[model samples]
Target: MQIVTEKLLNLGVDEDKEINESQLVLLDVKEDEKSEWKALSLNKQLSDARAELFVLLNGVEDKEIQDKIIFNYKALQKFRKKENDKELIVEKEVQIQTHERGDVTIYCDGGCTPNPGKAGSGIAVYRNDKLSELWYGLYEEMGTNNTAELGALYESLLLAKKESENGNTVEIKCDSMYSINCIKTWAISWEKKGWTKKGGEIKNLEIIKLSYHLYNSIKKDITLSHIKAHAGFEGNELADRMTMYTIQEKSESFVKYDKEIIVVDILKMRA
Candidate 1:
């Protein structure tokens, strides 16, 4: 029977007794016989896999291969739900409530023109309501917006992971939901697929890989979220500003300090 390509890949099929998406499931199959499984219609195949996908057809369909997957449909739905979950509103240099616990916040962003052309990145941190530190770099040549964004995020998180002398928990934030999702869920597959979606020319492979490594460096669970762009959000606005700062070579605005405390605002997006 046909299975969703993603589902097949995710289930690690063929590892041992692995077969299909539904193979590892404990679902009480309506049928137990292999013949019954073979005779099942296609929808049941997805259902068996416990896929969160939905029907996308113009008419009531029948064939197993009639529908196309809405890539990232589940991720977007989950993202929207998270956005509505009491708004993890991360603000700028707003003294974190975690100072007593000694945890700091990090923000990162990046950009480039003609994508594979000139690139730039920025990283900032806040502690106890002040700009504890900032990092900005320029890519006179090479890379794209997505690459630069991943670069900025990776370097920033690296800084946070390194600064934790006591092995304190740190939080890193960014506005690119795709970046967050890819790092959290798709990094391995992307790596195995050569950083390309289907083993093609992965535009941002290097930086994406770097970001993945940085994410894994955290001793505690990582948290990432999307911040509204151009909605007068301070943390996001600064992240954008920091990114443009590198591209424009205006490196004077960034700061550096020790000791910080504030809710992490993961703000960064490219226009």
Candidate 2:
């Protein structure tokens, strides 16, 4: 998904050297100041780019690479447009309070059917290894698995903060390594870089930033771990099941799962 920018075409621009060669360039100035090279409205430009790329390659043969390229290109467009300004004003903030002397574990998951449709997130919370609460929702008509995963993780962080305030040490388990890395690993560097990445635009930056903020605020009492999905981890399996419940029921808000949890029955519910 490499693009040709003005710096690549021009002779001298030391600063442009830092830009990745494979970066997606939405627009660049033409030879004259008043003219532009490939300017179009963001959506129209992106549609054309995707069409041209797929045509060049003959078809969408490699889905992973195709998804990555399109995801980063769209992210770059959002970055350029400063589209998340209103979204950055998050209403929720972590508050520090005295602890209550308990321990809790939270398992969270998210998924989408058909890759880009009917996405939702789910969470299973346990107190001292005993099932205590279940949560699911954040439904989207058209959303990626990554967004759903991040949404679940963000909600888990909120619950973890609450548990931490209750004097409990909290552990959060998630199967998506990408989401975990975005919050616990890469976010530190991304924050320092003003939320821009040298490799490309940061995908899901808004939620990642919010999750990172909440995680850091309560990190002293909370631990985040990555686990294998559908590998006989009961909590993870339960959380995974929760994701489907919302999509099945067409729920949009992040709400509690009030039904009783018979492990085998709940597992079979999804089957």
Candidate 3:
């Protein structure tokens, strides 16, 4: 309840008028029965009012303010669950697909605001063309877009290795050709020359090295390819959104996106 109230207040809903407005959104109540939706806006009752607002917004739609509140409420709930578990809780569908699916695809991306400011990485995983998992994090206080892209690619490699180990074919789609080349093409030559490039010192060499080794180990079962960014690919778009979310949330560690918490409209395809 405290979490709900804090989020609401943070989102600019700190007033008695706002509380009454949200309380009245309760659908379909007679004049007398509607009193049950009495506003709890007193200093002593503000907490209850905020908590009830969370519940009231559950099925309400199309109102911008209410939508934001509901979305924040769900996100906070998922964050709390993750904190309590101390582990990424794999969805039942993902767990069951281990042996049932033979193919998996992962789309990943990363970027920083102002080119070298706060950065984040995002990844979207699919099993037989269906979204199975979403992950975002790797928050860098001060980092370049390239570094963030490399971080996202490295994380995808980690996921790819796991899928390959499960006897599943994996394909990683990244929007950065620079990232794909660094691990798949350039790394081979760099490895032969003691990780040196005559041009200059390699940027993000540490992550490149880690990703290169992991990719080699899973190369037989995995393929890393480049896909154009913002080309209307649902998975890629979702991954990009996840990356932006990391910046908005300032999460330093990778967090699993709980679809049940809020619907990702971009992931839904149009016929």
Candidate 4:
């Protein structure tokens, strides 16, 4: 649980850190059916903890460290499941490949101060590991952190499209799992469901739609990867700094293209 606490702290989830960490450390038991329910709930908590740990450790290049983490994760998964449940199976192994020459990488981040207030997004595009372009902008109106994140991705995709025209593969690196999930995975289900979630209305539906469309329109190969925020990745760190700058300075001059200018205008209008 200390590891969980440390990971949450690294992720900037400070508000519930102490409480969640304490919950993991302490447990109450009673001899009744309610205790069975409590056990199930505790299992859920353990599963969540294991998932967070996996996310934090993902994309690690050290084979020894990756194997150890995977072993622990699989053990925890097995321990948490009921006897009647199917056994956990390793699906496909994930091999993290280093960015290759001629690969175009885009590192993007977005955030807001005081949630739903003063939101902004930033992007850093790299060509063959060299910084090619940088952009950041403030939303004209208040928006959630996810919106800012998606905005960064939207802009990055646009840049990727341009770069891909020269026959380079595009890889997008971002810290927002929500935004990544929306485009890469959940959008397929949402499309099948007529753009509705079972829980209710989907947030930022229009932006999601536009982003999904843009992603498919690009003819070149595109890859999306989630990176841990503020974790010393140079491009990601630069994007994060740009987001902070936009939030604090309220300036828009960092962006360079008329197309980008039009995109920001559309984002503000949609927002």
Provide the lDDT at 158 for model 2: 86
Q: TM per model?
A: 0.49, 0.63, 0.63, 0.54
Clash count for each candidate, listed in order shown:
9, 4, 0, 0
Residue 192 error, candidate 1, Å: 5.1
- Tens digit of per-residue lDDT, candidate 4, span 207-226: 89999889878734688789
lDDT assessment of candidate 4: 0.64
lDDT of 2 by residue, 5-95 (tens): 3433232223333212122232333334323332421223233454344333323345576567667767786685454433322312222
Looking at model 3, which ten-residue stretch has the lowest summed lDDT?
Answer: 37-46
* Candidate achieving higher lDDT, 1 or 2: 2
Overall lDDT per candidate, in order of appearance? 0.54, 0.73, 0.73, 0.64
Model 1 spans > 4 angstroms off: 1-101, 113-117, 192-199, 219-221, 250-271
For candidate 1, give the lDDT: 0.54
Model 1 Cα lDDT, one tens digit per residue, 56-158: 3213133343232333454676677566433422221232333344556777777676676777777666665555655666454666777667776776665
**lDDT (tens digit, per residue) of candidate 3 on 1-271:** 1432344432433333333344444322244554443333222224444555645554444477776776787688778767754554354225534545578899999989878999999988888888777888888889888999999998888778777777788899999999989988999999999999998998899999999998888888888888999897888988887878888777777767765523356454211
CA error at residue 104 for candidate 4, angstroms: 1.6
Ten contiguous residues minimizing lDDT sum, candidate 1:
88-97
